[model samples]
Target chain A: MRTLLFLLQKEFLQIFRDKNLLRQILMAPIIQLMILPWAANYEVKNISLAIVDHDHSTYSQKLESKIFSSGYFKLADYCASFNDGYKLIEGDKADIVMEIPANFEKNLVRENKQKIFLAVNAINGVKALVGTGYLGNILNDYNGELRLQWVQPSKISPIPSIEITSMNWFNPGLNYKIFMVPGILVFLVTMLGSMMCALNIVREKEIGTIEQINVTPIKKHHFILGKLIPFWVIGIFVFTIGLTISRFVYGIIPVGSIGVLYVFLSIYMLAVLGLGLLISTYSDTQQQAMSLSFFFIMIFNLLSGLYTSVDSMPGWAQIITDLNPLRYFIEVMRMVVLKGSGFHDIQHQLIFVIIFAIVFNGWAILNYRKTT
Target chain B: MVAVQLNNLSKKYDKGKIVAVDSISFSVDKGELFGLIGPDGAGKTSIFRMLTTLLLPDGGSAVVDGYDAVKDYKAIRGRVGYMPGKFSLYQDLTVEENLNFFATVFGTTIRENYELVKDIYVQIEPFKTRRAGKLSGGMKQKLALCCALIHKPSVLFLDEPTTGVDAVSRKEFWEMLKRLKQQGITILVSTPYMDEATICDRIALIQSGKILSIDTPDAIVRSYEGSLFAIKSEGMYKLLNDLRSYENTLSCFAFGEYHHIAFRDKMKNYSEELLKYLENKGHKEVEMMPVIPTIEDCFIKLLKN
Candidate 1:
């Protein structure tokens, strides 16, 4: 234990001495948290729409006005013919086009039915999909209004319909920042924990200080703990900074117990730091350790369910996410911050992370060689 | 009692494609200063690394401070202090911090073993606050030696400690080693410079992973069995070629200002005949004298055989 204290002291002294590394650690979280949540938004907007109205009828104008007022789209062109609108779509100036056939009001009033065509540029798939969905909803509402107006009170017959209403429980407004901040915070902490610790030991190796360390009487666990504790502290410091930014800058407050969140974060740090140390043990140089770290962190970040819902992934992919440490942290962060979940709700995730902590740390300790 | 021992130990690199330390055996008695003398790539560092438990031996065994190297590695590591050929101290750390760190990890305090490193550490103590990387090469070496000695292990393994140091610093380093030996610390130092061999109490002349001879420096030089002479002349380069072509010349190599040559057979008036031959070859102001063999001369003679 005394030996561990001395080792920790040396590590901290070195860390503090390196000004560039100190700046990187303290500033990375603040800068990334402030910028990433806003840029990585999934809510698509500003879709460009082209209008081709053959009939200058009031109803056609009303539909055109309705689409323009929806806030999700901007008018790219107002063309007189379908071909003119089609040209806007082909030129990539418009994301969608709406065409109303000639005599549209005549058919609607005489036959009580009308048809309209919508052309979506499917090249930008998300914009096309969401834009078409929005247009469909507007046309349905317009049709319902027409029906209500055309029916007289005496001739109206009862018709049955099912209307579905969804209440977004956690994020009622569906603010992308609210949904993304907690996950991004978790990712930032994981990155700081793993990459920094991975490079620490390998730097000693490259500088040849590790040989001096290896020849000493120090126990393997003491050495590993000495390395693990300092980075774990740095990881938590970065986590706190990220959380503060989310709360003050984004107005996000965790509804769950702060104690529960900290407990999970502490355990999660061990798992990540252990993984970093494991990489450090297998590598001979800092460059090799960094590349290996990049490989794993990349895979973990993508499969972490931060950007995409884990449930929506294919079965094989979902199974792979079960092994990712980041996936659990992101889930727990959201559950605690957004869902107001307590320790009881996160027990399963906590247990899995504890297992990861054990497996990774134990494997690292076993692989660390005092003599080879 | 033996402080360090190796019996038929061997190490191979690249899956046996290169033999770093062929099967060899030697030992250093307790409190004796031993030297492994050889040029670079002659397996001096390999021997030190294996003894310090930093490397595993491919064949046979090594015992350090009464503990088996492979099986009791943990025990060996505690008792041995190694200074690798490369300076292995933390460059980013100040000298005092580096020393304190090594002391603490060895379960000892600087005050506890202060006496052991006092002579060496005091030399570098004035610059303790400066970071090690900023120190001059000689100061860096002194600090490294102090860190290794902070724990005051029973056996000290220093590999090429004076290889790149200045002449004055090298002389001081050897003096410090002499002082440490007086304190009854068994020191095993390796060097590529043949002149440094005389400082060791005993040395093993190693070449190509094999021991050419192992003895006291004086005894090794006394074992030379040929008439050796130092010869000098105008046109030193041409003199070397002319002497090698002579019928009686067995070996010729440049040694500083003069060339040292050995004769296969020395008859009466052979020196006068050799002088006449060199003059006929357009050599001027030639000088020749029989000289005593040094360790280098003995080494070359042994290598020739």
Candidate 2:
């Protein structure tokens, strides 16, 4: 225990002595948390639209006005020819184009039918898909209005329609920040915890200080714990700062008990720090450790359900997420923060994280030897 | 009692492709100052590492302070202090903090064993607050030594501690080692400098993972088989080539300002004959004389045989 205290003291002294590292540790995460959630927003908006009206008829003008008033699109150009509207899309100035036929009003009035063409830029597939869906809904609404005007009131038959009233239970306003802030805070904490722990041990190897430590009477587990605890404390500190920022800067507060969140967080940090120690044991230099940690963190970030829902992934990929600690972290963050879940709800995730802590730390302690 | 013992200990790298330390055996008695003298890549560091329990031996067994190096490594770790070839102290730490850390790690306070490192620590105590990375090469070496000694281990291993230090500092370091020896600490040190070999009570001259010879410095020098001569001419480079071409030259190597050469056959007045031959080859200032062989000369002669 005395050895561990000395080791922890030395580690903390070194950490606090390097002013630049201290700044990076405290500042980088805050800056990333403050900015990344906004940039990572997936909501598509401001779709530029171009329209061509060869008909010059009252009904065509009405359709154009209805599409513009829907507020999901902005008019980029109003052209007299279809070819001119095509030119706008080809020049990348418009995301979608709508062209009306010359006899649109005559067909709708006499034959009760008309044909309209939409040319959508498919380069950005998501924008094109959502924009076309919005325009389709508006055209359908306009068609219903036209049918009502043409037909007289008969009061002989009844029409049936279905409406969807979606109540987003956790986030009523559907605010992206509320959903994203907690997940991003988890990611920031994981990155800081894993990278710093890995780099700290590998730095000792690079500078040859580990050799001195190995020749002493210090137990392998004690040294591993000494390395783990300081960064664990730092991870908690960074997480708290991130939470304060989320509460004030983004107006986010956990609906559940903060104490439950910390219980999971403490276990989560042990797993991550243990992973970092394992990487350091296999690597002889800091460069190798950073690259190895980066490879794992990248996989964790992509598959953690931070940006995409895990259910939507392919079957094989979902199985892989079971091995990802970040997946559990993000899930629990959303559950506790948005769903107001208690410890009983996140208990399964807590078990996996505990197993990870035990497996990784046990393997690290076994691999670290005083005599090789 | 044996402080350190090796019996055909060996180590290899890259799946047994590169042999680092061959089958070698030696021992250091309690309270003795033992040196492993050789140039770089001579396996001095490898031997030190294996004995210090930092590396595993491939073939045989090693015992330190009466504990098996392979099986009882934990007991040996508590009884040994190792200063690796490279400066291994934490550079980001202040000198005093580093010392205190090592002391606490060994479960002792500096106050408990202050006398063990006092002589060496006092020299660095004034700069206790300075970060170790900011210190000079000599100061860094001193700090490493002090940290190694803070635990007062029965056996101390110093691997090339004075390799990059200045001349004055190196002299002072040897003096400190002498003082440590008087305190009855069994010290095992390695050095590439031949002059430093004389300071050891006994040394094993190693090369290519093999021990060439092991004896007292005086015994090794007195054991040289043939007459050795230090010869120089006006043009040292040309003189070296000319001396090598001489039919009787057994071994010729540049040693500082002159060349130390040995002949295959012992003969009287060979210096006169050699000098006369050099003058005939258009050499102006030819000088040759018989001299006693130093440890380096003995090492080279042993390597040649």
Candidate 3:
């Protein structure tokens, strides 16, 4: 225990004494936590639109007013012809185009049938589909207004549509920040625990101090634990800061127990530190350690269901995400924060994380050599 | 009792393809100042590493302070102080912090064993708060030695501790070692500097992972049998070439400003004859005189033999 304490003290002294490392550890997470949530949102808004009104009638004008008032589409250009509208879209000035047919009001009044063309850019397929759906709803409402004046009272009021209501749990307004803040917390913890630990060990190897430690009387388990515990503490500290910011600044409160979140985070932090030690054992230089950590972070964040919902992904992709510990953490965060889930709701995920932590830590300690 | 004893120990890397340390045996008696003298890659570091229990031998067995290096590593680690070749002290921490760390590792305090490192630690004491990274080469060397001695181990293993150090620091370090030796600590030091070998009580010359010779420094030097001479002239380069052409020249090598040469037979009077030949080759002020052999001369002779 004394040997372990000495090693831990040495590690802390090294970390605190290096100004560059201290700055990176403290500044990176804060900056990422503050900036990333604002930029990473899947909800699209303010789609630019072009209108080609050939009808010159009150009906076409009404249609234009209704589309603009929806607040989802912006009138970017008023083109005189279809070719002009095409140019607007080709030049990237517009994401959608609406063309009103000539004699649209006359045809609707005389024959009760008029056609309008809507062309949407399909490059960003989701945005295009959403805009087209919004336009279709407005057209349907316009048709209903015309039919109410033409038909009898009984025909218009015979059947009433059943309205389906949705109330988002925990986050009633569906604020994207509420969903993103927890993911950012997970990212910060993982980066701090794994990358920093790996770099610490590799730095010792490069400086040749590993040989000095090997010659000492300290046991391998004690030395490894001493090195791991400091980083683990720092990771938890960073996680707490992120959680505080999420609650106060973003107005996101955990529906589940905060104590449970911390418990899961502690286990997850150990897994990350173990991964870092594994990388350190394989890498001989700091550059290699940094690159390997970067690779894992990139892949883990992409497949962790942090940005997109797992249910929306393809089946094979969803299956692959099962193996990512970050995916499990993200799910647990969502459950505890948004769904008000208890231990029973997250038991399976917690068990998987525990097993992952044990396996990675075991592999790391087994591969680590006391002598070279 | 022997402080360290190895019996036919061998270590090979890459599955016996690269022999780092061949089957060799040596021992250091308690309180003896022993040296493993060899050039780089001559297995000096390998031997020191094995003795310190930082490496396991492929074949044979060894004991350090009555404990086997393989099976009794934990006990061996507590009883020995090691300073590796590459100045492996923690550079991010201050000199005092590094000293305190190593002392704490061995379950001791610097105050408890202040006398052991006092001589060397006092030199860098003024810069106790400065980071080890910022220290000069000589200061770093002193700090490393101080850290290694903080626990007051029974034996010290220093692998080329003075390789890149200046002459003054090297001399100062050797003096500190002598002081430590007086305290009854067995010292096992390795160096490529032949001059430093003279300071050791016994020296082992190693080459190609094998011990070529092991004896007292003076005895090794005395064993170099030949009438060695230093010859220099105006055309020193051509003089060496022409002198080697002489039939009586048995061995010739350039040794600091003169050519050291020996004859095939003792009865051959080759010095004057060689000077005449050099002078005939338009060499000016050709001079030759017999001199005794230094460790370097003996090393070269040993390599040849």
Candidate 4:
């Protein structure tokens, strides 16, 4: 235990002395909490729209007013012909265009059946689909009002409706920052911890100091542990700062107990540091270590669902994420912060993190060398 | 008592394609400074690594401090200190922090063992707070040595410890090793520097994964049997070629300001004959005389044999 503490002290001293390492640990979480929330939004507003009204009637004017009042679309331009509307879209000034038929009101009055044309940019296929649906719903409401005015109220029977009261469980507002800050913190910690430690060992090999250590009476496990503890502490320290930023800046308060989060984070940090040690053992050169670490971080971040919901991914992708510890960490963070989940709710994830820490750390110790 | 013993030790890298350390046997007695002198890729480092328990030999049984290097690696680790060819101390840590860290890892305190490394440690002790990466080459070398010696091991393995160090530091380092030797510790040091070979109590000249000769430095130089001469003229290159073409010259190679020539037999009045021949061959200010061979000359002769 004395040896372990000594090693731990050395690691801490090494970590605190390097300013670049400190910066990397703190930078990611700060940006995620302060800036990311403002940029990521699911509800699209202020959409540019163009209208081609050949009829030039009161009905077309009223339809435009309704579209503008919904606040989803802004009137970019008005065109007398379909070509002018196409030009507006081609010029990138409009996202959607609506064209009313010639004599639109006369046709509606003389013959109850009339048609209007709607065109949307399909380059962003998902956005286009949602925008078209929103516009269709608004027009349907307008049609229903016209039907009520024209038909007898007693003759039209009321249609049954099912109301959906969606309570976004963890984050009521579905703030992307609240969802992302914890995961980004995971990424930064893993990248910094693994890269720094990997380089630390390999750098010794390159610089000839590894010989000095190898010649010593130091045990292999002690050497590896001494290297890992400092980075692990740094990882947790950065995580705490990220949590503080999430609460103060983004107003994201964790629903789960802070103590429970720290316990889980502590285990997760070990798993990350273990991974770093494993990389260092396999690599003899700093360049090889850095490149290999970059590869792992890229794959881990992508598969961990740092940017998207894992539930939305395919079943196969979800299974792959099961092996990724960061995925479990993100899930636990969201459940604890957003849903106020207790130990029972996050017990499985916590266990997985513990197992991961043990396996990775064990592998590192097994591969590390006391000499050469 | 033997500090290190190896019987039929062999290590091959890349699935038997590259034989780094062939089947060889040697042992280092307690309190002796043994040197493994070889050029790069001569398997010196591989042997050092195997004895230090960093690598497992394919076919060998070795004991380090009475512990089997393979079966009892932890015990070997606890008894031996290894300084690899590369400078590998924690560059981010201060000199004192690195020293303390290694001491702590070995379950010892710097104060407890300060007396052992005090000579080398004190030189860099003023820079205890300075980061190791910023230290000069010589200072880093000293710091590395201090870290390695903090635990006072029964045996020490230094793999080319002075490979890139300055001449002055290299000299000072060997002197420190001599002091450590006085403490009755076994030391196994490897170096390509021929001059360093003279400092070891016993030296093994290795090449291409095989030991060519093992003896004292003076003995190896003494066994160089050919009559050698150092020849110089206005055109040293022309002089070398001209000497090689001579009827009695067995071998001619350039060495610094003179061309070292070895003749087939000892002939009385050979210098006068050689100088007269060189002058007639259009050479200016020709000078030739018999001289003693250095370790480099002996190594070249061994390679030829």
All candidates: TM-score? 0.95, 0.97, 0.95, 0.91
- Model 2 regions lying over 4 Å from their true place: A150-157, B267-269
Clashing pairs in 3: none
In candidate 1, stretches whose alpha carbon ends up further than 4 angstroms from where it belongs are A80-91, A153-160, B241-249, B265-282
Q: What is the TM-score of chain B alone in each candidate?
A: 0.98, 0.98, 0.95, 0.94
The candidate that achieves the highest DockQ relative to the unseen native structure: 2
Q: Best TM-score goes to which candidate?
A: 2
Kindly list the per-residue Cα lDDT of model 2 for residues A1-372, writing each as its tens digit. Answer: 888888888888889988988998889878998898898777778899998887889888898889888888899999888789889999999999888888889877888888899999999998999999999989999988887786676776345556567898989988898999999999989988988899999998899998999999999878888999999999999999988999999988899999999999999999999999888888989999999999999999999999999999999999999999999989999999999999999999999999999998888878876677
Looking only at chain B, model 1 earns a TM-score of 0.98
> Per-candidate DockQ versus the true complex?
0.82, 0.88, 0.79, 0.57
Choose 2 or 3, whichever is better by TM-score.
Answer: 2
- Report the TM-score of candidate 3, chain A only: 0.95
Encode model 2's per-residue lDDT on B1-305: one tens digit a residue: 98899999999999999898999999999999999999899988989899988999999999899999888889988989999989989888899988989989999888999998988889989999999998999999999998999889999999999999999999999999999999999999999999999999999999999999999999999989879999888899999999999988889999999999999886644777788788888888787888999999999888888
In terms of TM-score, how similar is model 4 to the real structure?
0.91
lDDT of 1 by residue, B1-305 (tens): 99998999999999999999999899999999999998789999888889988899999899999999999999988888899878889999999999989998999989999999999988989999999999999999999898898888899999999989999999999999999999889999999999999999999999999999999999998888867899998799999999999998879999999999998874434788899999899999999999999889888887888
Q: Which ten residues in a row have the lowest lDDT in candidate 1 chain A?
A: A153-162
